[model samples]
Target chain A: MGRIKTTNNQISRREIIIEKAATLFKEKGFKAASMREIADVVGVEAASLYNHIKSKNELLNIICFDVANRYTHKMEEVEASKLTTLAKVESLLRFHIDGMVNHFEEVYVSDREWKHLDNPYLSNMQNQRRTYRKRFAAIIEEGIKKKEVKKIDAATAVLIMLHAIGGIESWHRSTRKIIGKELEENMVTFLIDGLRKI
Target chain B: MGRIKTTNNQISRREIIIEKAATLFKEKGFKAASMREIADVVGVEAASLYNHIKSKNELLNIICFDVANRYTHKMEEVEASKLTTLAKVESLLRFHIDGMVNHFEEVYVSDREWKHLDNPYLSNMQNQRRTYRKRFAAIIEEGIKKKEVKKIDAATAVLIMLHAIGGIESWHRSTRKIIGKELEENMVTFLIDGLRKI
Candidate 1:
């Protein structure tokens, strides 16, 4: 693999530390992975890491908040598309599916080990997650009102759909399992049938 | 609520410590919750807790293994039910849902914090989970053979179903945000519909 060479005089050190720490946290988990290890991974002494970040908790917040921000921003773009609620969900599912495929490690770090975040970061991430859930819920609620979907709890339906999509990162083998368009088609159809009124 | 107490001498001090520790571990998560806090919750000195369990990690092993054993054993019983594949999945879903509702603490403790388990325990639990998933996969495979279920990857189908049911612990809240039964019925219909050939 190519070494992650930080620009000597351009990019901020805090940004570098956050980027390197995200990879470490993803590999070893938030608790089991140490600040010292992250520092080493970033090509710096342990003490030097504190110059850019206050603690391990801060790094977690940065990475999680960063991902959550980007994910919701991506959703905003999707929501703007002239797509039906069903189509919006399909595109959203595809975005998440592709995102997990490309960023599988980050997904694991954020989801499985979120308990490591300190109070402020934890609360912020939780609120962001609630917002993300509400986006899909709102779409489902609209569909139900329009009689486009069967009567169902919009929140629960969205939760189930999102979890099923999120689960692909954990369960997909990539090497042994099918992939590309076929896999996407199968996942979309399965999710749609599960959510659609018909 | 009435305290879980007993007059029987068969429940040793060690068991009490483990039970209390499991409750704390589930509520606060394995890594964040402390051993000293566990001792305080159990009304014993932290040092005294060592007499019953060697380390915090060991205590986690005991709780995880215990729940994994229970979940796997119950999964086997569900697999043995004399019903069609869809009915069997419904039974499996009911078992996990009811168990989570009744033993909410134990299931929560074992599931959300599974990453804390080390070598043997982690591998053992992983195996147990794979077996649990395989039970559903087998049912899907059987359905496919009988031409009742559409052709699909048994493992993926099983994963979708598991996500649908296991996700309840995280998503369910008593508030009027969602009517729980409607959600469950939608899940059942959604899954069954997805597996039906067009």
Candidate 2:
């Protein structure tokens, strides 16, 4: 969420606060992160911090919904494309991997801290995730129908893909052997390629 | 852990307490699952639970390390076998899937609730997990060397496998479309079968 102001590509103070808070939230959990702490990191008074955001909970909402919205938006683009079922799945997988690797802070925090999200937000987040997975499963189902992919359980395939992406969190923490593009390439090859090649 | 007694194969009261504890732990978390709750579930007085086990920590230790030990022992047995690399990987995957499917309470509680374990146990548990993943990666490496598996990053392959297995928790919670052996078989076909076939 760049939220750029003008053609010069200036990010607002709000974006800066969000970025720094994502890091802090990743280090200390949502429950532990404070407005004073966020204010300190953003070089503003705790009072000033509230001018841009309402509360710690609001930061979480922004972070969580931002990541979810980005994925949903991307899924729309991928699904609408004229790409084949295999390409569609690979494109979506790359999007998830890219988010995990580069946008590590927001993506990781969003995935883990969603449990702390409030009712309407939490319920909405769950629905978004459910819808996203269903749409993903549908792509594989289409592949199976067109005889372009293996006749396997599509929902299971989606489950494997999503959780495999989640594995990148451990990948982030571990002594990583591959970085960025290579990791993305390798996973795409390992996952969706099977749906079509076999 | 069947720990079946002689002949008739009866599980002891201690075993019943452990089983009941696992379910309570899974439901209410290790912290929330008090001695009183475990006793209530087992139909014993809270005082009686202490006779069989020292504390909640022991129960967590039993659940976490028990699962760890079972996997380690199984890993040893599978490693000792003269099976081919592909077969060995398939064997391990089936072992994990079996654990996730059949032993949901113990396995689920163990995986999620290990964080509440004390220092030595936490450190030791981390080591066991690290070693297990390394060993799993080694098998994939061996498969690659033997030209039985694709030339992919072995460590990443292990990451994917383990996290994919973690996905089974969601499978347990979701409206499951497939059951035990079918889930295991589908996963095996999706995972290790690629190593040789490709």
Candidate 3:
């Protein structure tokens, strides 16, 4: 019982560090923000931070991988929907936008601190994203075959959609300038109309 | 005459550092690549590098600002064209694509290292990009009014298309299955077709 309690406490403390570091890293960047600064914010000595993680790079890697995996998992849910190919694309785009809005900090950290991960870890994260992209492309391919979507390049169509979705983190703050629901509705319609055959 | 020769040499050396640093930043990222490494590649000591620039972050700021400025300049030219709105959008997408393909390294570094720049510098770049995005939205706004584009939220339409264009740098590689020209052509078709009124 004591051992379990101790482990739980350790995990909690580590998470505290990650939360604090994530905010700083998002604001100042991974290279510019130092370990001492992170420890200072975490209310621990710089050396104590080493006890929870091997290095600053490892901490950054954990945060990035965690966020990316969350996005991948959310995308998986979209992939499982019973919608048509075009609808699935729209749903997936919304899911991506919602994810960015809800988890802006995590997504921001993942993108900015991606380089801190070691080679194998970085490659794994990259592959996960690529696989997610391929899943989108597969949906486009299905739409093309069904003649629901114009016979455009499936890869290109999917990539274009992904780009639009992925970039929401950079610009979503100003979404209120137009009614959010109205803007989203129009975006969906515009995308669908663009994909349909004339 | 001696002063003129020294000034030219300084300019030449500064160019060499920027060129080499851009390449290194692309391969290893801005954080991982250091002042010493940049200097070594330029055949100078680490201290000598400071003579050419204020700091590493300043180098990054210069490169990124130039990209934002160049992109805005291209948009200005595209705006002046007498082509149809659809054609103009296609031209804009292609122009942005050409910028990415030709200066992939520089663009990639600028985008990824944006946080390194101080607030004023970063804000300037951000506003410049916002102005550029406004140009795209204005095009869409005009198109909608002219019945060239379907009635939609002009801002969202522009945002989606711009995201699709900018995201090209993340995935465009020589080894990719699609060739550059074909990809650009398909993208143009997708954007125009997606926006056209039925």
* Candidate 1 vs candidate 3, lDDT winner: 3
Candidate 1 per-residue lDDT, tens place, A50-145, comes to: 777788787787777767877899889977887777778778888877877777766656866676787877887878887888887888777767
* Model no. 3, DockQ: 0.45
Q: lDDT (CA) for every model shown?
A: 0.71, 0.80, 0.74
Q: lDDT tens string, model 3, B1-198?
A: 111122444467677788889988877778779999998777778888888899988889878988888888888888888988877877777887777777887887876677667789978877887778788889877877788777777777777777777667656642466777887877877776762224
lDDT of 2 by residue, B109-151 (tens): 8877786688899999989988998898888788788777777
Per-prediction interface RMSD? 4.7, 4.6, 4.0
- Model 1, span B51-169: residue lDDT tens: 77789999888777777888778777877777877677677776666666566667777866676788887888877887777776888788778766667677776666666665676
Number of the candidate with higher lDDT, 1 or 2 = 2
Clashes of 3: 1
- Please give, for residues A1-198, the per-residue lDDT of candidate 3 as tens digits: 111122444467777778788888877778778999998887768888877788888888888888777767877887787787777777776766665666666777786568677789888877886787777788788877877788777777767776775566545557446654665676667566762224
TM-score of each: 0.85, 0.81, 0.82
lDDT of 1 at A72: 91
Q: Which residue pairs in candidate 3 have backbone atoms (N, alpha carbon, C) closer than 3 angstroms, thus clashing? A: A194-B194
Q: After superposition, how far is residue B155 of candidate 3 from its true place, in Å?
A: 2.7
Candidate 2's fnat? 0.25
Higher DockQ: candidate 2 or 3?
3
Ranking by TM-score: 1, 3, 2
